[model samples]
Target: MSGPAPIHVVVVGSGLAGYGVLRELRKLAPDATLTLVTADDGHFYSKPALSTALAKGKHADTLVTTPAAKMAAQLRLDLRAGRGVEALDAGERVLLTTGGPIPYDKLVLAMGADPVKVTIEGEGATRARPVNNLDDYRAFRENLPNGARVLVMGGGLVGSEFANDLSGAGYKAVVVDMLSHPLAQLVPQQVGDAIRDALAAQGVEWHLGRKVVSLDRADAATIATLDDGTRIEADAVLSAVGLRPHIWLARDAGLETARGIKVDATGRTSDPHIYAIGDCAEYPRGLAAYVTPIMAAARAIAPSALGTPTEIRFPPLSVQVKTTAYPVVLLPAPIGVKGGWRKVSDGSDGLKYLFEDETGRTRGYVLTGSLCEERMDMDRSLSAAEAEREAA
Candidate 1:
């Protein structure tokens, strides 16, 4: 009889994916020796809450419902915080870290992503802030003066959310970006227009079709010079350009990586013993950046990690509008899949856009305002289409 199977497991990263993996593993293999490692403070909070943090009057500390100590205690797991991974030895199944090398029967990389950096010339440019983690938020909060003039760079989701939250927090917020509207690439132009109008009413200024060329320190304020030579003075500048998957380590370790670390359906790397998930892992089909897909991947990978035969296919996610003001819902067309959008709009108050493929089957949809009434029908249609595709 085989002695008790190797009981060691090492999970990297402390974000949602890492924690979720641990949570699922504990339920399935309670006797397994589990060790979690992370490079940052191990506080646990819903990261999606960061989008509306300031507007909800919540500080980073308040967002953390479970501290790292409590999490480790509750799960009966060993937790390592503020430790950076040095390298991966796939052949040996060892993880090299600042603490030391850890050998594991299974290894999970939920490494997450890093904020993209933007470079601008000027004195305070080097000091410009990007809030990617709790420490960064704390640093920004400490450095920001009361009643400060804040200039946020970018017009995407994070930038728009930051602008709204900061303005709601009583800061004089100004957002500058090259895009014509907020969430320009993600949502349709009509929806963008509505959001722009709503945000403008809330005192968020839009600097569309403009880029900051330089940032300099001017006495107590920072001066941001646009490409067109227009100068805007602000107390601080917050850069929210976007995020790129942290894939350098994976790449250096000789793992296949593109926009993200490439992983199979089971989150397995090129080496079967190692696996990846969350924002850091990229599916061959495309990047699914939302939390829903991350959860799906984790659920599928857990059983496989425990040596169970589980073949699960990720289903297209049902997107719901979390913002109460606009009351919009969308199921975005999957990436790499071509489709056409059929739209019917009633000014800014009601709008519906359906994305259908070559066969006239509904693959995705977007509904806003009163048009949300057809969501059930749209979902049913898509579900039937998916079923048919599976059967075929």
Candidate 2:
């Protein structure tokens, strides 16, 4: 006589977060039924590599490390590619997709995030593109002519990386942002200045403290109007403003959402059987949108999804900025925490900055250029300080 039916775990999205869950779950329960559903082709590629591929002379197709079929065979997962979930019925434990309804014992949401689009007025406004995915990168490359002058909007991590990559690929890159310096949100002013100067030496133009007001087509080129009445002509524009979590599905399904899908320490949503991770999941402080946090969440949530409950405790994770012109590693202080930044060292090679609170507790740190090699050591120091705070 057959015993209880095999538990089927359905994971939405095939990106790093979803794949991480699948990998960990398999190790815990090798015979567990697993299915992966994604809107795009389920090929495996490093999402971070999209920003630097151009500099390395790599195409979108070549970026994929493993094909979908091969990954499915190796992982023993039921793969559903190029199919989006139309709706979700949490009460019935079913996902409504174009193919059909998929019944599952547990559901995992790792739908990722969407690029934030900036609205501008003009005929050439539609020409501005964002390279958030492989398909977007392919289209951007196809539309860009040789030696094209590309206008990059925003000065955050993604924007800085793209600007450097474009310049390295023999294309002219001009970055425009409303902030005074590049990566103002992530790094100190001095660090940002160093990066701006280094990238400038490599032929990248910086148009800081100005916003793109509009984009108008003039003859064969696109004219970008800045807030300060400055005009620049370019062949293409790329916007790397930021990313917003894709939480519409979860919110519409009656799940709680803040900046992202609200989840507990165990990655469990409002519904006990539903869990989320990656950029789409919001923990207590905020969304941990980086790779390390996602992997940590996946490891903590896998056992819980498989019936053995576990909780996640995220340690401090350093963000490694992918700007080839000037490498940077930053561990930002917690939001709203009272602290002040102090310059530790400034030399020809690079600079180092640290953040500490009133009680002499080290909260965060940033290292640039050759000094970035001290990342692991600084991370350990930060961890020790955190341990002391907790012990007290």
Candidate 3:
């Protein structure tokens, strides 16, 4: 009699989450057969590093840590590169791709999110690059002349970080956002002001509480008109508005999806044989688009996918704001949770704010500058459950 067939696992996507699970699963079950499929060339690179790479002198070409073939060889898996998964059939356990139909005992959807499109009218509007990936970064860098003035739309984490990076890289950065302050998605007003001051010192211009309603061309320059009738001209436009999870794949396959592909605590999708992880997945803790949660989910997902169900849980974690001028460690307040940020400390040492709920429970916290060292204390106090719930 022939030996039992090896467990065949097909992983879609070539990003961090895909590697995270594969790395773990390989160690656990070396005999398992793995197949990696992706739309890109499958060059391994860090997504978060794109914003900070300019200052570090790293471009798209240098950003790739490993090539796809090497990754497949290292992980001992079948590499299917430059193939887009067109459709998925849950009942048949098959995936329709650009190449052909591929069958697997288990499937992992790690296909990431896409840039949230923004509506801006006028001539230069189409010139804006969301800069969400290496390709966009490459194009942005090529178009950016030395000391170019970049108009960054959105004062959220990505925009603020890019502005900081551009400033550090000897370029002028002008930021615009409808919110009253930078990092308004999470940080308190005072913290935002501090960041504003820090970035201003680094030569970053701010246009808070205003939206770029349109973009026009002036001579060789791009002119951005704000909602309040304020016009600013720059060399290039970079968008950092937001990102939306890829749900069409899961939805087409009849898998449940919300803000993202819905997954249980163990990262298993509605279809028990199929699983979702990374930015594409909205798990029990919520939408995990960051590294920490994705890694954690990957750990639990590996064993569970192999017939050994593991309860996925998070380790102590906090998302760091990457403005080197004034660094920040923050746990964003949970959505639908009533809470208010209260100052814990602020002075020459830096700023700290604790997000407390109506019940006086510390739900989240933000620490900046010197106060960032206290991240461990904050991490310990913030239960892993609460941290997982809110930090994502």
Q: How would you encode candidate 1's per-residue C-alpha lDDT over 127-229 as one tens digit per residue?
A: 6677877777767777778767889999787787777777777787888998887767666777777767777777788888899999988887889999888
The model with the greater TM-score, 2 or 3, is: 2
Better of 1 and 3 by lDDT: 3
- Residue pairs with colliding backbones in model 1 are none
Please count the clashing residue pairs in each candidate, in the order shown. Answer: 0, 0, 0
Local accuracy of candidate 3 as per-residue lDDT tens digits, 294-387: 8988889999999899978875558988999989999888767887999989798888899999999887899998889999887877775565
**Regions of candidate 3 where Cα sits further than 4 Å from its true position:** 218-220, 384-392
TM-score for all models, in order of appearance: 0.92, 0.96, 0.96
Top-scoring candidate (TM-score) = 2
Give the Cα lDDT of each candidate: 0.80, 0.90, 0.90
TM-score of model 3 (CA atoms)? 0.96
Worst 10 residues of 1 by lDDT: 318-327
- Relative to the true structure, candidate 1 has a C-alpha RMSD (angstroms) of 2.3
Give me the runs in candidate 1 sitting further than 4 Å from their true place: 318-325, 347-349, 357-361, 370-381
- What is the C-alpha lDDT profile of model 2 across 48-144, one tens digit per residue? 9998999898998999999999989988999999898999999999999988999999999999999898899888998788998889999998888
